[model samples]
Structure formats: C-alpha cells, structure tokens
Target: MTRDHPADFEEIARRFSHLWQALNEGSPGTRKILVDRVRDALDRGEARLRDADCDIVANSFVLEALINDGAATRVYRARHRDLGTFHAIKMPRPDHADDPVLRKLMLREAEIGMGLRHSHIAATQTVLRLSDGRPALVTEWIGSRLAELLQQRPLSLGEITSVMTSVLSGLEAIHAAGFVHCDLSPLNLLADGDLSRLKIADFGIALKRGSRHSQFDLAFAGQPDFASPEQLAGEPLDERSDLYAAGLLLSLLLSRCHEESDGTKTLKALTNHLSQQDVQDRPENARAALHLLGGSPKRPVDA
Candidate 1:
C-alpha cells in the first residue's frame, strides 16, 4: 500500500491552526474565551517551530502494521513515504492524547533521541502528529529486546562483554551530549541477533543534565525490578544512577552464567553500590562494569 507522506511543518502548523479554530466554534461564552486562549498558545507553538527551522525530514511516517502495546503507548511498524522503507512509531493511548504533561514528556524523549547519534543507541527518526491529533515518535525499528534473547539462551561472559561494551559506549556518547537516561533496564534495551549487537531504546524518562525539569522527583522510571536504590529512595541523580543500573545488569548476567550458581556477591555489589549513597560507590560507569567483567581488579567475589 502507498503511504501518505507527512506534511511540512509550515503546512502542519496551518492545519493545526485551522483545527484549533474549528474546536473553538459553537462553545459557551466562557468556554469560547478559554478556547481562544488555547488558540493563542497554538500560535506561539507555530512561532517556535518557525524559529527552530523545523525539518520536514523529522516528520513521522504512519505505520501500516501494529507492532506491540505497552502501558502508555502502542508500537507500530510503519513505512515512511517520505524517507521510504519501514520505521517504528510510538503513540500514546487515544484517551491520553490531550494530556499536557505526558505529551511534553513524550516530545522531550523524541527530541533527546533525535539528538543522539551512537552505534548502540536506537535512532529517533521523527516526532509527528497522528491523524487523530495525537503526538507520536518515529524511530529505527529494532527486531527484539535484549531480555528476550537472554531469556532464551544465557549469554557467555565473552558475549555479555560485547553487549556491555557497546551499551557503555552508547551511554558515554549520551553523557557527552549532556543527557541522562533516567530509565535503563532490559526492557528498554533492544538487540538484533545477539546480545553483543544491542541498542539502547526508550527515553521516556530521560532528562537534560541541567534543565530545571530534569530535577523532578521520578521515584522510579521503567521496570521496578531493575530500578536503582536512589531511584527507589526518590533521590536526585546523575550519571552514577545509570552506573548503578549497569551494575544490576551485570548481576543479571552473572546469575545466568551458571544454572546452579547463585549470584550472591553480584547482588551484594549491587546493594553496596547503592547503599553507600554515593554514585562513586557504584562503578564509575558502564566502562567500569565492563572492566569488572574483564576481571580488572581481581576481587575474590563470586563470579
């Protein structure tokens, strides 16, 4: 089937204005007043787009097939009429499209993803408005989550090393861009054929390093089982928070190492890494975890 291409930002803005006008029609006097105020806000949004010199390439393509469903969004495999071929689109539930805070957070996630360019990071293709006026993000289509493969066949130490290295490299690139992926877990990690060839996905909880909004108390982002202690304690965090998560991930790998071996020390590392209440207590970052996996320190802890 031939897909419809996304309109340019200017055209999209014009359509948005027209839609706002239509919504304001036939409203009660006070309701009309509020609608008019909202219309003004839409105008400001258009101006911001103009000032930003929006890219038409950044428009999301509509997917022809549904991929999966999650708590707040649905995934689809879409063909980009403009870009050509397929990409994945994530859209919020139909009922929550008008939620201001949720929408803003989704946009932020898209923006951050788009800015990131890393071999192990899933690239964001576009952030566009759906036919029903809901916001959605288009991203490179990943075949499966890392967790799925790990569940099927446990990863060898050498195999886990490859995955860890790439994961850390991707994260380092993100840190260099001055962003923190507040949400890091197996569910958010995707892989192609093997664990070594993995890509980091899902940025709904990511934040700019120093933005005021970055300081909001997000007790735990994403899966609770993989959440760090500081995340559980509702404390503000930075790169170290990510490190703690990487440590937990390492423990998961260690647990899967031997079918009969219990991962007690690995769990101890995770606990102490957070109990110290210091990011430093956590390995410096993904690279540090990789170093530990390589037997750098030569500790007598159970592997």
Candidate 2:
C-alpha cells in the first residue's frame, strides 16, 4: 500500500513502539532513546500553516503554491513529506513578526483554534515556527471562499439552508468554547465545492469573554455590512455578535434564493431580529437562531 507521510512517520512510529515496549519490558536505556527522539521531533517545529508566492520548507512541510498574500502575512499550500498530505500554512511577514501586538494576535488566534472542535469549524492542526523563525499555523486546506462561491452560481433554497445551518453550527461550537468570533464575515467563511460543506474560519480577531484584550492594543472595527451594532460601539462581545453575522449571511443568501418569494418575509424578519441595535432584542446565541430556523443545535458548554 502507498503511504502518505514522509520517512520519519515510520521512524517516529518505531520510537513510540519501542517506548511502549520499554514500559512493559523494563528497559530504561531503550526508553530513554525513544523519549529523546520524540522530544527532538517536537522541538523541531515541523507543522505550521499556508501559501503566498514562494516555495520553502518550514519544518517537515514544504510550502508551495502562493495562495494568499496580505500586508501582514502570507499563505501557502504545503506538503507534509512524512504523511504525504497537503495543508495550508499561515505565517506573518518577517518584518511584522517583530511587532509585539501583531505577534500576540497571531499566537492568540492559534491558541483559540487549538481549543475548539466542531465539524462545521475548520481544524487547526498545529502551530510551529517557520524557517525564518516566525510562528505559523497549519490547517487543513479549505477549498473555496463562500463569497467567491456565491458569485459563481445561484444556490437553491435547500442549498442555502445547508450552508447557513452549518455556519451556525460552527458559531455554536465557538460559543460553547467560551470565545467570541469577533470578526465574523462572509469573507472569513469558507466552503468546499457545491456549497454542501461550509466551515466558519478565521478566528484571528476573536476575543475571550471577560478577558481584556486591549493589553495588546488591538481592536476590531466590525465589517460594515455584517457587523452587529454593539460591535461597532467597541463593546465587549459574547456569542450574540457571531449570531448576528450568521443571520446576515443567511439573509444575503436567501435574498438571492428568491428575491420576492413567499418565504422572504420570515427570513427577513429573522435577519432583522439578529441585527437589532440593542443586543438584547436579538437572538442571544446560535442556539436561538437554530430554534428560530428549526435545526438541531449543539448543547452549550459551561465556563
């Protein structure tokens, strides 16, 4: 059978197998060698996250296919030589890495991603140092942007429902994890081909509830069309802010589904409820929206 990972997967596996054997075989010398090997592998910082305009090896992954480039960071499609799997690596520009606030934001995003789990949410695989010694985050490659996909074709009501439901499911998961995706927007949501699979992504500006993030002197100016009013006011947010963006996306999709259809009124009302200037008037969280729209929502997790 063909294997996916590089040569080290087997070497790493061998080390682990020996370590397990040492546990039972009462072999301290053998165990020490295996443990040291595993530690060295980890200290090497093999996995990082995406592509811009270059080909290089950060650790175990080879970065290629310059996919996105911005002022602060670059993304590249990357390959894990050991596993033979492809992923995206995101890392800061070398110069920006020296800015304390930007550096903190990058690391904070990684920390938040590492803590959350949901099928509708993109998986953040690992955070490691780049060849240039900057921190990078590696994640499974998302196929397309939702904004880009919508422009390509008109989706049916059923398809829009699937996409919105999936997005809300992801927001619900973010809430259960006690972090607000303070920067939710269509631009940040990703989808695979056919709009059947959607994942809420880009937690870069996310904030933990009750934590003072101004320590880094970072503030999010909400997206004009999709941001909640409270977000514009720079108030500390909770899950409600994310629900607002979810509602906005749902409305935008529905408006395109059938501009003057019979179901438009109800979806419009739901969207308005979500966009209410007073956060109290809106559905407090994704669960509330799921209740309004009728879907199985995840149970909330305690702090």
Candidates' TM-scores? 0.67, 0.75
lDDT scores of the candidates, listed in order: 0.67, 0.73
Root-mean-square deviation (CA) per prediction? 14.7, 10.6
User: CA shift at 222, candidate 1, in angstroms?
Assistant: 2.8
- Return the top candidate by TM-score: 2
- Write candidate 1's Cα lDDT for 1-303 as tens digits: 223445566677898787667676745775666665775576557656674322222233445767787767778877764457777888887768787767877898898999998888999977878656778788898878877877887655456556666677778787778777867778788877756668898888876763333354343465666665666666665667777677677667666665322234443454355334466666666555555545422222222
Model 2 TM-score, all chains together: 0.75
- After TM-score superposition, the amount by which residue 11's alpha carbon in candidate 1 deviates from its true location, in angstroms, is 34
Q: Taking the tens digit of each residue's C-alpha lDDT, what string does model 2 give over 99-193?
A: 77777888888999988888888888889886556888898888688888678767665666677678778888888889888767767878766
lDDT value, candidate 2, whole model: 0.73
